[model samples]
Target: MRLLLVEDNLSLADSLTRALNQCGFAVDCMHNGADADQVLRTEDYALVILDLGLPKLDGLEVLRRLRQRRNKVPVLILTAHGSIDERVKGLDLGADDYLTKPCDLTELEARARALIRRSHGFDSAELTFGPLSYDSVSRVFSLPAGPLSLTPREHAVLEVLLMRGGKAVSKDALSEKIFGLDESSSPDAIEIYVHRLRKKLDGSGVAIVTLRGLGYLLETRDAAA
Candidate 1:
């Protein structure tokens, strides 16, 4: 999943980015809240890790504007303010979850995974489509035979498709989720990953179908039949 991390603390941001990436999240970090606010408005993210203390624009204001625009992307507030009033205010402003600074990495990752799962309307960590099952927490994909071996890019593409279920995911969306905002990857890069994934998933009961200009959809062979 792709997540935006809005934090000015370079050390914390670096650590969180590495940890989240290891946890199977493609993270884009922005130190300035103004930039983050604009990115949130323009980009599609699975979740946002927002820090209340920001440089140009306050994180609370960013949250307020995002809510005012009716953007429902899940947000988890990471701040040093540990007061009940502050927590209440953040929640009121549309934060899905709140975590104070100096938090354990494990706890933060757990909260992130929980929020992402909930945002996707999944009650559990395991997502299944036909014989394919993915454990979101462990970032593992499995079939009836055994665990599926997929390159990181292929796995990321498959995750996005599975998250959308039967819906078509555009190439632009896939590129954004896979390469993130900082990378300079073409839409053709997405096609390469999709082609590789299709070859690997052949005869797996699930197929990734291209809809021409409409993009790609993951469907069961039986459904297509």
Candidate 2:
């Protein structure tokens, strides 16, 4: 999935970005809230990690404008302050969750997964289609035969499709979700990942199908047929 991280602490941002990237999320970082607000206005992200002590614009204002525009992207707020009132205010302003600074990277990752799953309407960590199953916690894809082996890009592509369940995902949308701003992205690149995933999933009873003008759809073999 794609995520936007807004934080002024360069060191902390770098660590968090690296950790989240390792977790299979394509992440974009902004150092201040103004830039963050501008980015959010145009791009779609699965989640946002907002640090409240941002410069140019504070995180609360960014969140307020985001909600004012009716955007429902999940947000996890981070701040140096541990005041309950601040936490309550952020929650009230549409922040999906909160973490005090000096937070655990492990905890941040877990919370990120939860927010993403909740946004996608998944009530649990596991998502299944036909014989294929995925564990959000473990970030593993499996079949009855064995675990599915995938490169990082391939894993990301499959995750997006499975999250959509049966919905169509355009190549552009897929690219957005899986490629960070710094990474090179193209429709052909997405196709390559899908092709690779298809090879890996052969005879798994689930399939990724191309629908002309409708983008890509993941479904059981029966549904595709």
Leading candidate by lDDT:
2
lDDT of candidate 1 over 1-225, digit per residue (tens): 899999999999999999989887889999999999889888989999999999999999999999999999999999998899989999999999999998999999999988987887888999998878999878888877788899888999999899887899999888887777777789889888989988877887888999988899888885334
TM-score of 2: 0.96
For model 2, what is the C-alpha lDDT against the true structure? Answer: 0.91
Model 2: worst 10 consecutive residues (lDDT sum): 216-225
User: What lDDT tens digits, residue by residue, belong to model 2 across residues 1-225?
Assistant: 899999999998999899988888889999999999999999989999999999999999999999999999999998897899999989999999999999998999999999999898998999888889999999999988889988988998999999898899999999988888888778779999989898887777888999998899887875224
At residue 157, what lDDT does model 1 achieve? 92
Regions more than 4 Å wrong, model 1: 222-225
How does residue 62 of candidate 2 score in lDDT?
97
| Separate clash counts for every candidate | 0, 0
